[model samples]
Target: MSKPALAVLLTRHPRKPPNILQTLLEVQASLGFVPADALPEIARSLDVTEADVAGVLSYYPDLRTARTGRHLIRVCLGESCMANHGAKVLDRLRAHLKIEVGETTRDGRVTLERTYCVGTCPVGPSLVVDGDVIGRVRPDQIPALLEEYQ
Candidate 1:
């Protein structure tokens, strides 16, 4: 985002308390993803170190320093999901999307990621597309599931 926008957002909410996390969230909400250029300004606005802002950015999986694709596909690779052929599903997704975990597709349509769990162990191979958790995912279902996002 532009520096002017950051200044406007920072000074916009004087009535509310100044907090590091809240400020970052607001920035992310407004800008889609927190821009790398935003760290210094965010730190200055919150009176925290730039490292503080960067740390929060790295610590939170939801807070991304870079912009993501139009759709995010995160497949669960936890123990149960692995047992249920989650790895196979992930491989199929990788091959279909032509991108590895933590990378966005060339067309910027989708981003593929790997998560330890989605809290549905019994379902095993679970898939989360844009925050919607889907259970019992299979390798064959990968194309249809991804097609929805496309």
Candidate 2:
């Protein structure tokens, strides 16, 4: 995150009570990923150790330390989706992207991730590309769907 942005986020919550989690979330929302440079500042503001800040970040899966790709592809692994061959879809995506779950492609075009559910069980085999939820996804559809993002 840029210094100005970080400053704005910090000043936005100048309350007497400290809310480290909210501050961290604000930073995450502003910057797609939490910049390492902001940790010491956050720790100082919250009157805690840098390690404490890091521990909180590590506890939340939504918080990211590194930059993400242009597009995020999350495959749903819920029971219904899994039974509907979501695993096959994930496998095909990994093969096509040449990257495994929780990894981004070399070009930084896309990041593949796994989620428990997307609430599209009726359709099942769902995948979310960017922010669009795609249901009833198939292994064969991976290439064409990926093309849209690239």
Off by over 4 Å in 1: 12-18
- Candidate 1, residues 56-83, lDDT tens digits: the string is 8888887888888999889898998888
lDDT of 1: 0.85
Please tell me which predicted candidate would have the highest TM-score against the true structure: 2
TM-score of 2: 0.92
Clash pairs detected, candidate 1: none
Candidate 2 lDDT over residue span 29-51, tens digit each: 78887888889988887788999
State the lDDT at 138 in candidate 1. 71
Error (Å) of candidate 1 at residue 52 is 2.1
TM-score of each: 0.86, 0.92
lDDT of 2 at 119: 94
